[model samples]
Target: MTATMMTPAQLARFEARLLAERADAEERLAEFDGVMTEVRIARTDATADDEHDPEGPTMTQEWSQRSAVLADVRAELADVDRAIARIANGSYGVCTNCGKRITVARLDARPTAELCIDCARQAR
Candidate 1:
């Protein structure tokens, strides 16, 4: 099936959105890094007994939660970087799976999406 290509204006808007997303992801990653550093320091503190405190979550739990979030943000940043590369290579808004045009609405919601909705749903 033939698919309509995005106009230059649409591409520009999507690129801007993706760049903003990248920045947000980077900011989250930095925050996570700082928190992880603090957690590491707390873990090594001689006076703290997070493992047996029973007052709140343990240091390990906090580290695990923050690590998971950090990983997610890193993945998002990678996706944004890839989307930017696709725009640079004239492949933005095109589904990699079926070589079809991804709908503008989908792109608006997920500028880093590489597959069209149908292919994405099928992949699940």
Candidate 2:
């Protein structure tokens, strides 16, 4: 049998999911930005006295955590953007690596996924 294509309803549903995911990622990114800003401010405000205080978390440590979280949020936002583009280009539910139809269940679970389950697992 020929690989089934995504129906209009499926496309619409995935579109909605991608859009919602994008919004959530954007919000998280903004939140992280605010937090990173705070961390930078605190880091800059640190004085010679704070250097000797071992009880408080070091600004370097806080900055590291904030940077890591921000990177993850940005990556998620990029994935959402790519997925939306794929939707527009008529290839949203197609596996990029295997060129096969991704199952509806997987698409429903991760509209931003770029590969089939097998490829994804292998990638990991």
Candidate 3:
């Protein structure tokens, strides 16, 4: 394989890792959905009064925290999906910013990465 291209074995490994990440994110999102549903039902109770109860976090706070977690998981799933698409288009191991081959070590650590270490650090 050329320097810019990943070997077939490396491609397969990265693809599998990305797919697993996607699955985990999807599962977490589903769990969050179920918990959010329960929270919504609890909020509808006429005498619950969680806001003034002072036992723990209020229902609104729980809902907001869960929503933020759900959003992060959804973003992770999107990134994984994009990485998979890049694999299909023969650009999986190339950095989007510098157009260089992303190091195998970096990809092994973060299969959904879109930038090389240098470009990524520069962005930060």
- Give the top-scoring candidate (lDDT): 1
Residues 72-116, candidate 1, lDDT per residue (tens digit)?
A: 999999999999999998888889999999999998888899999
Ten residues in a row with the worst lDDT in model 3? Answer: 46-55
lDDT of 2 by residue, 1-124 (tens): 2233888887998899889999999999888888888877676567544766563476678778889888988989999999999988888878889888888899777878889899999999
Tell me how candidate 3 scores on lDDT: 0.85
Model 1 lDDT-worst window of ten: 46-55
Model 2 has a clash total of 0
**Sort order, lDDT high to low:** 1, 3, 2
The segments of candidate 3 whose C-alpha lies over 4 angstroms from its true place after superposition are 1-4, 46-57
**Tens digits of per-residue lDDT for model 3 on 67-103?**
8998999999999999999999898889998789899
Q: What is the C-alpha lDDT of each candidate?
A: 0.86, 0.82, 0.85
User: Stretches of candidate 2 above 4 Å error?
Assistant: 1-4, 47-57
**RMSD (Cα, Å) of model 3:** 2.8
